[model samples]
Target: MTEQKRPPRAIGASGLSCFPIGLGCASLSGSYGPSDDDNALRVLHEARARGVTMFDTSDKYGNGHNEELLARAFGNARNSVLIASKFGNMAGKDGKVADNNPETIKAFCEASLERLKSDCIDLYYIHRIDPAVAIEDTIGAMSRLVEQGKVRALGICEVNPTTLRRAHKVHPIAAIQSEYSILYRAEAEDVLQTTRELGVAFVAYAPLGRGLLTGAVQPGSLGDKDERLRHPRFSAENLPKNLELAQAVQQVATERGCTAGQVSLAWLLAQGEDIIPIPGTKTLSRLVENIEAASIILSDAEIGFIASSIPPDAAAGLRYRAEHMKNMYL
Candidate 1:
């Protein structure tokens, strides 16, 4: 079979560039559920075959298993694709702690490179901010990676506008990865403005709302082992309320003759050229569904409806539990 061609697009604030839509590999290694190596590799290969040239993964995901899976899947294509990996969330001395110390940052980058089987990472992100360490100190360490040719660019995940600016002051932040979807418009309305003002690209993770907006996840649809089951938005008490919000999205999507997922992603793409959504899935059908969203455009009226339909805090429950929520927006 002939290989599928990748789409031409720029990535990062520097326009140091890559594919517009990246494949978020978190699911391949089973953050959501169990996945075999063979199945995971097939998904990666299929994504590449479909022209996905940007792959995003993190060390904490599957406890480094995800990176190893990517290395094995993209052995030869490793250089062809822009590999974006993250660090700073690995277990620390306390066993289940997060650390972003300069020493830890450097060590983590080295380990990620070894696992990815690459000489240099296309884009490296700090998975989560460690409150104990100053943002500048963390970013300063990351900047050194760029100078050492270990990382091509630097990014941060789940950071606030102030943190973004602080990090940018230390080094040019190429991108910011955060939870953004039709159901989660709080960031788009405000955080997006900050990223735009600073010329930093926003990488939207969970752009499908952990399958909520995709019309695939109904209350009790997720397996008990799934981590999302514990998420406030997906908990038993909030699931019905959240589903109601998704149903409203479905109505709008029906009017537009597109899947709810497509409407959600298209709305994000329309938010800004600097915005990129990395919605992950293990199934080929779902992967294709997500990629098509890039082409789904919304008229001004349609965009307004979507925006108003799901207000920033429209969904029931907090995005994450209190413990995890404490780690975000830092």
Candidate 2:
């Protein structure tokens, strides 16, 4: 097992501590493109060897393939890594996200535990808000899982202040997972103030802007199967403009002698200690690059410079399509 070289950062008041940077694991399930199972397992083991102690997954990722992948990769090493999985968003046969109901929350939690081959989940997140069900009802059922010892900590993803306040009243929220990157910031930055006030750790998913900030993906270069192709920022018209923002990140990376992805991750790290970034990769080299980003120190001026280069709302497209965006930040 890889030993932790630095002190762990705590998440909210749940007493859960992990390396500030984590492996998001979405790519392992082929969210980006096709993935080889053996190679994905190798990447997971390599992440452990390199001190990435937190692994984030969701039931909706490849319809539980990602969770099962985590189970197979970790094996006996499960205890050494923090397993964070989510529920609430169900994918239908039509490939559309269904409503989040209490029944689904309980049933999904049970199914997730079975797939993970673990008795308890370290961190369980409600992947997205279900407008059909009250936040209180959903969180109330989640609190029961905590009481039953099935889940150690509770978290909610992509929720606004009102929902956070309501959910916290039912159970202490350990963290808030959202698409927070320098590339997409308005809503998440506003949510950060509330999470910080409530002492909830902000888990920044896609902290690398779904690979655009890494200066790797270019307009018209993504594979057809790549999920990013469905995102607005990656659209043909917006992609050219988004690449300009990526160029700004790349320029800084060149000046600092680091990868553009590292510069983006470093910028997120500089936001606050309470913020933790989970940048995903299906390869070991990119995993190590993301893990090493924690050491890239940025001064206040550099942070401001990067911000100016890619101002808030500068990215031309929405983070998700209209149908998908409706479920986020509720």
For each candidate, the alpha-carbon lDDT, in order, equals 0.83, 0.88
Once fitted onto the true fold, the runs of candidate 1 whose alpha carbons sit more than 4 angstroms away are 1-9
lDDT: worst 10-residue window of model 2? 1-10
**What digit string (tens of lDDT, one per residue) describes model 2 on residues 1-330?**
112244677889999989989999988888999998999999999999988899999998888999999999887988999999999677656565645677767789999999999988999999878787888988888998999999999998998988999999989999999999999999999898899889999999999899989988887789988988889998889988988878878888888788899889888988988989999988788888889887778777778999998888898899999978888889
TM-score of each: 0.95, 0.96
In candidate 1, residue 233 scores what lDDT?
Answer: 90
lDDT of 1 at 302: 79
Model 2 ranges with Cα > 4 A deviation: 1-6, 92-98
List of clashing residue pairs for candidate 1: none
Task: Write the residue-wise lDDT of candidate 1 on 124-233 in tens digits.
Answer: 99888889999999988888999999999888999999888989999999888999887876855678778888888888999989988877888768886788988899
